[model samples]
Target: MLNLTSPILSDGLTTRSISCPNYSLRGFVNPSSKPRPLTAKPHQEIKTPHLSAVAANATEPLLFSSRAHERDQKDRRDQKDKLVVIMGATGSGKSRLSVDLANIFSGEIVNSDKLQFYNGLEITTNQMTVQERQGVPHHLLGEVEPEDGELTAAEFRSAAARAISGIVSRGNLPILAGGSNSFVHALLAERWDPETYPFNGRGSICSDLRYDCCFIWIDVAPPLLFEYHSRRVDKMLERGMFEELAELYDPKNDPGESWTRIGLWKSIGVPEFDRYFRKYPPQKTREAANRDDWDAARKSAYDRAVREVKENTFLLAMKQIEKIQKLRSAGWDIRRVDAAAWFRSALSSPDGDGGSGGRRCKEIWEREILEPCVERVRDEVFCLGEKQMTATYY
Candidate 1:
């Protein structure tokens, strides 16, 4: 409001002037505004970028998604593609636990055990029955063609990637469960031993697919696992294990144990029983009911074969444990679910009927193994993620 007297001093400045454009330095002020002279203190306009409301208020790690709906949808899709691997040595109850996880999580089981992938000899392969699955959808089981030969690890990765993508598209979890370490590893890791697989290591042997994987290792001590293998062999015999072995490795027909020389045909039960087949020669021994000495010798050979199978299974289990630990070292997310205490509790507890003990074991499993796993998947994989990880078994 510098209503200065006109022409007081043409060059004299007023104390201050604002909104009084009727005067200037020379006469009142020019009717238009002009720049004020600079001073020692500077005036600056401060501005800060806007932050997301959720992020600004959050106390924990924030999971960020795009502002656009389409980007949100893509984020959701990526989250859904998370892969769950249930892995362990032979007779570690991987299949059983996998079924439990899948059934609880609305997941579909993908067979990773190479033997279970074969269509023939469901008995020898130790395939789980529909009842055993308890209504969970399973994939890749009994899908392999015998004539296709052993599927190379690379081919398995391709197939698994496709299956996982398809499952995620349908809004279901893909649960890969079995003992096929290299095959499973191929899908998750960039590098693997190509020599072990059917394909030669050409170039990088890399699969272009990747997934956020949760690897669950169903673990048991070696001695306990060997006992399971022995008992499983005996049960297999009861369920026509030798018959499948006979068909797969008949000494008279194939003669040279050619199956033993092949790749996956060298699976656990295959090699151990090869010698037994040669010695007893299933074809000759099957009709030897009239000879006591021959049957007795065959019985001796059967025990020996079972013992060898158990021993080899123990060795294989050790290798599997070693491999699993190695994979962990290579940054694979591995969590071990110990079954020893649970088995002991379930089998030897009071009520002896085992029903209550089995139920208790299930409870322990839910509390210890399943819940923590779901939390890990939520925190690590999803961030209270789009998939809405829920308690399945409980």
Candidate 2:
């Protein structure tokens, strides 16, 4: 049988095919450019230039073998494809540690935080900085518009999967980072199944549903979560939350496919209040009778926002804790770190009490929270790689 691997094709004619008599018969030869006599026979021996030399050139085999070796090297490099999904309740420190670990592991940050995907409101959404991104590369952060309403967990998972693939293809580790617990769980497991319920997207999506991926839950406490959220909103306000909210109000600058479709335009819904305020601007002085009415309306809107924040955070915390328990029972590597340690690690340097304060917090984080998570991810990746190798060998 002919060796199909060889580049040369052999015919019944043993002579070089290029010098065949059929070539002259077919008018292929340049008679003026070559010697007058050209010899060819249909059944004669044909010796292609490389045919007689391939056996002597060991480099040819070496080049062929190099392809397999190249694949092996690529496999080794991509063995780090196993993802470390950092999940927590709202106000938990998922984003902080995710970014830090990404830096450490030559990884890319996939934002699982829903709010942080918007175009503006960096402070309000707590989006990462260019310096923090550090050419380390982050995906999905600041990629959406504020008006885009109620992007479901399914949408987040799809975006995350694409982001993860892009990261892995570029030979970087993918760190799924966010405080949205459902987003993290769903992406890791690839289970988009939401609970069957009455209203649209209202029912809880069960994390126990089967999926081809993995889930890691970062356990956090309630009190710390409350405090973190309260402080976060306060900080956002101090950092010009109103200005960002105002910018989103332009009737002409319509942000289609945004949270606005679901009627969630502004962060605090303050723009809605602003609309009210504009319709009935506060009169110059208390002499105006309707001034009291306007002030009361304004305060009511603000108070409503505060109430909403508090209520939403509580419900999210409860749901997230339940999800964590489910993932743990489902044979996932769920690591519950010290809540205080995780909370402290989220403090940015300037926000830290002092240099020493930040350093101490960093030490605790590396020792208690982050190190263990990294170890778990590495172990899982190695185990999966071993399984794949065993299957290939068989």
Candidate 3:
């Protein structure tokens, strides 16, 4: 019978013993010692190359084991196939940030804003200008025709999925940026439950995510955000927003019925200006001679419409914020970056302050919002070399 026993030596090393019945050969093998030939000639010496020497002398490329290679491929796929979602209220700079991140990450943006999806009403929907896009490719922005029909959440999910797949197949990051929470939920949630899809408040929506996602929430204080929205409305007006609406307006169509049409017609400024447009038809307003009471009534109606746009915009921002809060409460790992300071600075700065105020606001935005978000995205996507990025609640 052959017997084997492993015993701890005095040096804390494990040694194995082999024994036989007829001819007992007892030896202690030190596992940590260099391996030796089982049998050798009387006057021969065996030399083994040192590990470093072997590596230095090797001419062929080093190869990973089959298992190691497979693991490496999986890691590469995980690193490449990631989604960055930017969610926030209107006028929270979501579009600008998306463009900036796409530039840094070599990504393509997929727009999720419901209103921005439709064509026309560029100014009314606050669509980004070609110059403002900074040469980054944006998907689904101004792609839909309002006269066609309303775009459902499911349809958006399908289109967005295809866009993301194409972006990933081209070895580019897919960045979904917008304030359309319903579309966002529809796309990212693992399973769809129509009744409680967007804001279940029960934390069921994000229980299982469909993709590896990093969500960024650009947050601002309510008062400052509302003030910023008002100022933005004024800027849009200056940029011929009313003219864009006028081009779409037709005296033959009923203002109330036209406003009720799905898609672009439902945009904030469009419906809000219905009464004003009806009262003062574009052509008639241009042809009518100046009369005190008539002009006064037209001006009053115009002012009221403008005020309604601002008020409705404020209310929309509130609802967007509420939905975002509900999402956060429901276990979405949303990274919040407060932008109230930047808004306050921009709002307080005197108009036309030699461009110094604009520069200062940009600096603040970079420091407070952009840099942190970049770091977070970097950690989420590229930091896989060191550790995996996992969602953290709250």
Candidate 4:
């Protein structure tokens, strides 16, 4: 009799004999052309059970059943769709955090900032500078034209899904970062719709319409935001924001001919022009090119530009912050950073302005933006489990 518990071998002979050590048992041996184990040491030829045979019968009810296999497949399917989403108020250092996290996680940063989507308004919109990208790969930035006219959050999410699929295909993590909170969540929580085609023959398997990732929200308090806004404008002026704006605004030309100014005031033309002009005053033509007058006029324009940019930025920041709060309360995973703290710190750091003051600015970012962002990304890694997690999770 075959022992079902014993390992299956190619030979039919059982390893355990029926005869006991104390009691001898006699059995009739069949005489056939094939030799028995007792005769000529079983006339051997090297042989083994075929692995293909075992595999072929693996799904049979005799050993394992297809139901268990199907269950495992379903479990894998569930895990495959899991995704992470990042959201926050703009200028709260979401981009900086995302870029850093992308480095550690070996993931690509997917642009969720609506302003970043446009191509022409690169400097005005403050899209990532080429040097700032540090040779790191990115997706979805500068793909849309300014003329596209108000690309919705829904549309951005759709583009995101396609980007995600391609990233997944390459076995890389997709770091969804930007200020478009609603759009990011919509992709993670929504079901796939047949009509929505996000990939357009790209490697992505899903439309940008899907949302299926963890959500990370960056934020700052209103008071801190106001301070940060003012300082950021100051930094921008130092970076020649006034010069850039002046080049765009031609007081003498028709409005249609100029580059559209981005951000709060929208443009630098007409009726409500005081809103911007007060901060970015135009220069008066000098009777002659007097160096002192020209220097003074330029300085005034820079100062005014700083003030205008700050005021408008504060208003916009407040509105964005309100949205962030609502999203957080609604059960989204939101991580907030004190941008004012960061701005203050930046004001003091060597990279910021220059020495003792630079240290203060750097410290503020450490307390507010950098530390919080690092913690948020770490939490994501913990959720995925450090053993199975890759750099992408962080």
* Candidate that scores best on TM-score: 3
Over 11-116, each residue of candidate 2 has an lDDT whose tens digit, in order, gives 2111111111111111112234332212322223555768547667765553547888788766544332356667667556676667666655556788877667
The runs of at least 3 residues in candidate 1 whose Cα sits more than 4 Å from the true structure, single-residue gaps closed, are: 1-80, 190-209, 252-260, 288-295, 346-368, 378-392
Candidates 3 and 4, the one with greater TM-score:
3
Return whichever of 1 and 4 wins on TM-score.
1
Give the lowest summed-lDDT range of ten residues in model 4.
Answer: 20-29
Provide the global lDDT of candidate 2 against the true structure. Answer: 0.53
lDDT (Cα atoms) of all candidates against the true structure: 0.61, 0.53, 0.71, 0.51
Instruction: Tell me the tens digit of each residue's lDDT in model 1 across 256-353.
Output: 54644544475677777888888767677677634365656777887788788768877978877876776676566688877776555544545322
What lDDT does model 1 reach?
A: 0.61
lDDT per residue for candidate 3 within 77-136, as digits (tens), equals 443246899999998989888887887666789999988988899999989999989898
Worst 10 residues of 1 by lDDT: 19-28
Q: Rank the candidates by lDDT, best first.
A: 3, 1, 2, 4
Clashes of each: 4, 13, 0, 27
- Model 3 TM-score relative to the real fold: 0.74
- Sorting all predicted structures by TM-score, with the top scorer first, yields 3, 1, 4, 2
Which prediction has the highest lDDT against the true structure?
A: 3
TM-score of each: 0.69, 0.59, 0.74, 0.62
Q: Roughly what TM-score does model 4 have, to 2 decimal places? A: 0.62
Q: After superposition, how far is residue 331 of candidate 1 from its true place, in Å?
A: 1.2
